[model samples]
Target chain A: MPTIVVDVMPKAELLDPQGKAVTGALNRLSSSRESGSGISEVRIGKRFELTVEGPVTEELRERVREIAADILSNSVIEDVVNIDFGDDAS
Target chain B: MTFRIGVVTFPGSLDERDAQRAIRLAGAEAVELWHGEHDLKGVDAIVLPGGFSYGDYLRAGAIAAVSPIMSEVIDAAGTGMPVLGICNGFQMLVEAHLLPGGLIRNAHQQFIRRDQGLRVENADTAWTNEFATGDEIIIPLKNGDGGYIADAETLKRVEGEGRVAFRYTGLNPNGSLNDIAGLTNERGNVVGLMPHPEHAVEAGFGPDTEVAMRSGVDGLRFFTSALRALAAV
Candidate 1:
């Protein structure tokens, strides 16, 4: 079995308020520490892991890419990255 | 012949009945359509009302975009059938690639409900022909993920072609680029907007009007415009 993983996130140019809010929360938590706001940026996104029985062929890879680009990610506001297949799949 | 307007009701849909009623108020026959149904009931036009479709899972309107009924909607829109997407329905349209751009969470990151003012930017569309290009109207707007975004080139193209159907007047409710509130396809049939026009179609029940004791029934123009478009055909 081969496991395919896809990660989607908002585009770099777009404002990600959700991610910003999380980063703000992180800053508030670390304000008392000596670390002193070590984090600079944070981005939130979605990941999908798919396991398919049998071998991972080139055709299957292409099909997964197509679906990832067309359905999993919206080109207008989000980008699809971290598309990889795990070799250790049972 | 009475124009048959189909109002699609998906799971979690909250405004399909309101859209149907608006269509009826416009003197058109309101037809109820289901998302799981493959047929559109031979409707002359279609309205995808707003709500948190699929519980806003994965993304708003992402699941409903590929639902069974959407295939028929895409086909009908391609053939110039009038299709209007409101709020969450607008999200589904963008997800389905029937309209340009995508809607994301508001800049303020909170659900907002208000009487929004909009200016008619393009009146030649099937859904906006009843208004003059510069006419300003008020309608109810309520949503969380209503901020609209698109690439520079695409925005320029839509703006250049006068495909921008409506623009938020006075204030940008959700930080939409260029104050855009609604858009139409190249053929002027498919339209999508973040506001709930169906909510403003009836008097007394709609938003308050500035004219004192009047209802914000400006949204009636959208449905009436659809009928006018059909009449010209």
Candidate 2:
């Protein structure tokens, strides 16, 4: 079995409040330490692992790409950042 | 003939009953439809009520947008069927590409519930023919992810075309761009908004008015507007 990894993230121009809240929490924790961590910003996203049987092929990759772009992510406010096929790369 | 409006109930839907009740109060037949079904049951109009469908998984309304019944919804909307989406239903509309733009997490990062004020921007749509442009109304709004966003070109085009159905009057609750609260499609048959209009249809259960508490029936016109639109056809 091969696994196709799809990563989706909010658009860069759009504001991400969830990511901002996480960044704020990290900054507050780092401020208490003697050596402050250099954290500028953070953006949270989603990763989907799709398991498929059989060998990876160009046709299958294209099909997965279509699903990633259309079903897995909405192009209006989010982008499909990466699609990775591990070990079974064609 | 009595107008029959369908209210779709998806898995985890919380406001389908309220929507059906609102339609009935407007002197129309309220038809119950399911997300997993393939039929619209010969409904004259459709209402997508608010709720956390699919538990808001994989983004709100994302999964439910592609459910079995949505294919029929998309087709019906294409042929000029009147459809209204409220709150989470609005999310599904945008997710299904029935309307433009997208809704994201609120800028304040908190779930907000309020009696929101809205100014009618376009009164010619199927769902808003009862209103006049610039008419202000109050409706109850509740949501966690309701911030509306779009690219520059898309925003400009939507605004230039007079597709904006409503605008937040007093305050932008979720930091929606341009204070846009609702929108209508090009054909003026489909509309989506982030407020719960069904909650405001009953005089005793709606937002407070100047005369009495929870005595506002502004939402009743939304259902009547659909009836009016259907009668003219």
Question: What is the per-residue lDDT of model 2 for residues B134-233, given as tens digits with 9 covering 90 to 100?
Answer: 9999989899989999999999999999999999888789999999989999999999999988999987899988889998889999999999999999
Where is model 1 chain B poorest over a 10-residue stretch in terms of lDDT? B205-214
- lDDT, candidate 1, B39-67, per-residue tens: 99899999999999899987899999999
Fnat of each candidate: 0.90, 0.90
Whole-model lDDT values for every prediction: 0.91, 0.93
Regions of candidate 2 where Cα sits further than 4 Å from its true position = A34-36, A87-90
Interface root-mean-square deviation, each candidate: 0.8, 0.6
In order of listing, the candidates' clash counts read 0, 0
User: Chain A: TM-score in each candidate?
Assistant: 0.86, 0.87
> Which candidate has the highest TM-score of all?
2
